[model samples]
Target: MVELSQTLLNLPVLICRLRGDVVQVETWISASGKHGHTGDWLVRDYITGETHLRATSSRYLMIDKKTRKLSFLKEAWADQIKPHVLDCHEYPIIMGDNRKLLQILDVDTADYVRTGLSPLWNDLDINQYVNYHIKYISWILEGAPRSFLESHKLSAMTVEYRKECGRESMLHNLSAVSRNGTSATNSTDHFTEDEGIEFDHSLYLQDGSEVLRARTMWMPKSI
Candidate 1:
């Protein structure tokens, strides 16, 4: 059942009905993986019953959170039968492991999260591209002001803004040592950018290289 269900996910289930934003998926449990378990699924577009997307191997799984186990149902799965979520989404949702793409490509990324704008990975100006990385950073750190960032860019920029923020997620893996000198951060964008946090970050390069640096300074008396 699980294997059969796995194939169903690979098949593009028809979006037969969409009300509000929910999408209905008409997936199937094929006849014992005849077509191709991770290979193919019989799907007809709901709008015209026209076959649009074909498939071979795909990624999908069902997990039972409470038990910390997975439920591989050979049927179907969709948060919204109507798939409405995609309609009003602010960020672009791509399938597959995007992390792998970033890793393989070795795209150089930097995060100068500060009161100043954080850099956008997509909008790498020649200077930023040339330098280890440079550009006013986009202010989309997880807790950074969301509405504030939204205000700068149109709603459409949310995805870009988020991608901009994610450009440096891998940096956390490095050690954040105690600050004894002036190589510490004090982001004007984040008034508390250095309020009391024990952190000094590194930059993630598009070339999959990291430029490590320290940020330190004497506590300023004036704002």
Candidate 2:
């Protein structure tokens, strides 16, 4: 029931891997594609490290609003002869877009994703579950500013940082899982008066070779 609309669907995506329920897309295509042929990777689904359904489109020239005709891919490159090669042997090439870089779902993460909560009771498709997660995560980290502040602020940073002290995990890392960026605290100074924040930060990776510490202090910048 939850279909990925335009904003999410058309936004440039990179190499995206769906492991169990964990989905991440990384896009490192040429930025110049925006003007001549903006390359995009639409990750519909993945299975066993293979792309299930994907769509890739190119931009040749601007399109006519009423006619929806292109004036670029042909106007400049003309035939150009695209190659017949797959970065990896995959399936489901449903458009004129390249089907490279699609990855399979990680079985470990897929289990979590497949069993995720569904807005519709009883059951929902994998896509639907992912949609719900996107909504839930977006709700938590609604504002990027708040996420940064709470996750990296001066006062609370030590609490998490200290927790990640030992255990041979990585090093001296703080793992304060939050939605937004800032912390839920009153202004240390006369700054914020409304709203509390959190962050989606990960634990640090330390090796004991160097002791790292940070804080929120006043520092006069040079002009």
Candidate 3:
């Protein structure tokens, strides 16, 4: 099984390209460990070499399918891959340190008030589980209010995947933590310049067990 531990997206890349435009993406393992590893991708224009976007992702490999236990890389395998691991200290950290950010996010708060149906499919990934990127897309589709979405664009997004979603349908729940610094019962209640909205999203099973949780921020669209 594969799990997406965290992700940082640079959304401005969408504005600089067009349909059928070609770009080059260079990906490398930024950090590695026995249980999981972090990867980085740099996307740039193929002709002028201008950078388009940067993305970082933390992922885990699981050995046991049922229990979802993380797999430890063998010593021999680690040795073989040592040459490919690159030191990420020089790269700009997008989501900040994963361990530190994980501590501040309140995943336990029962504030998910909005509800929607989350569909699951067999071909989401080769592992037979929902892919992390797909889950993030679903969260935006289900959680963001229509008015808020119309007026704003995602500037940066960070998601921490807590658990794997199997072939079971899920209940998507969204909680608006704030809109322009005040509590948001309705996301469109307060609109201000520069300030953005924040949300906490979760996916749960029919039995009320959470499969994924995420936090996303959106900036006001430029006039």
Candidate 4:
């Protein structure tokens, strides 16, 4: 009975810390219609009801960090688009009064994508997906932020994240086994070594129903 309500669908906003400024990027479409990367790629902006198109590409997987070269099939510009945070709340949002809302919440975009959907569930049909998406968007606009934040589900969100990670790991292992057969262990080891795919095991706890304010990347950490 868990549906993807808008309060749960994190905005599909992408941002990168470049030259000391946080810059946002729209998911791009290609001319041939066969190439692109849409991270947690939603067709419409849940908050603003703006529509976007998603495309597919294997090229994004081949991008090199040093080059940061955007694909030649990039719909508009030829400039290199580097890897960026998959989702960000810092994205530009034009309010009805033409004012800008300036909250930039940073979270693991992949984690955000997994928030609403359970690993074992299927879409059932197109209408079901659309209906759930609409409900999610509606909640984002009309739901009470204070009540949602103070709800017991807010505290349980981390547990869901852990379940998501477990599902992902299980799927990955299954894929590895299917692809490599007898060499599955070797392939998995290679994947772990090459990708540094470590799971975050830390727990998140809030003492009370008190909400915390946003904090941009103000602290320095060693790379």
lDDT of 1 by residue, 39-81 (tens): 2333445555665443333333443434424565433434322
Model 4 scores worst on lDDT over the 10 consecutive residues at 155-164
Taking every candidate in turn, the Cα RMSD to the unseen true structure, in Å, is 19.6, 20.5, 5.2, 19.9
Off by over 4 Å in 3: 1-16, 32-34, 59-61, 92-95, 98-116, 120-123, 179-192
lDDT of each: 0.28, 0.27, 0.58, 0.23
Model 2 TM-score, all chains together: 0.18
lDDT of 3: 0.58
**What tens digits encode model 3's per-residue C-alpha lDDT throughout 1-223?**
4333333332323344678889998887755455566777778889888887776676534455556766565566667767988876764335464333322223366344555565557435776666657655656546666787787776555566565666656565655454453344576665556666666555556676665555566666763
* Better-scoring candidate (lDDT), 1 or 3: 3
- Tens-place lDDT digits, model 2, residues 14-84: 23334565433433222223334323444444343443323332322444433433433442332232332
What are the models' TM-scores? Answer: 0.20, 0.18, 0.72, 0.17
lDDT value for model 1:
0.28
Best by TM-score: 3
Query: lDDT order of candidates, best first?
Result: 3, 1, 2, 4
Among these predictions, the greatest lDDT belongs to: 3
